[model samples]
Target: MNDHCNRCVGCTVQECRHHSDCEDFCTLDRVQIGTHEGNVTMDQCTDCKSFDRR
Candidate 1:
């Protein structure tokens, strides 16, 4: 992920895909194979278009 998005405090990338409502563009469910707690795979964030390094 980029520094901008990563530095954004309280910015959960999951919210971008609206995982609470939809799962179509959500990469979380695909990579996350363990507990639904902290088992989220961050690779999804790197591929996110919203991730701005600037």
Candidate 2:
């Protein structure tokens, strides 16, 4: 959790290093989105490539 907040990016993932503890947003200006499945199917298959474990 952090004190910084990037209003454009709404995030609820507390495990991420970019996630803000005071607000439901990210601290990064930009985020990378990716998929883990061989064939993109559902939303669960998607992932935040910019995520860094806290």
Candidate 1 residue-wise lDDT, 1-54, digit = tens: 322222222334454542323322332323322333355566543444443232
Q: What is candidate 2's lDDT per residue for 1-54, written digit by digit as tens?
A: 378889989989988888999989999989999998999989899999999998
lDDT of the structure predicted as candidate 2: 0.90
Find the 10 residues in a row with the least total lDDT in model 2. Answer: 1-10
Model 2 stretches with alpha carbons more than 4 Å out: none
Candidate 2 colliding pairs: none
Number of the predicted model whose TM-score against the real structure is largest: 2
Residue 7 displacement in candidate 1 (angstroms): 29
Candidate 1 is scored at a TM of 0.16
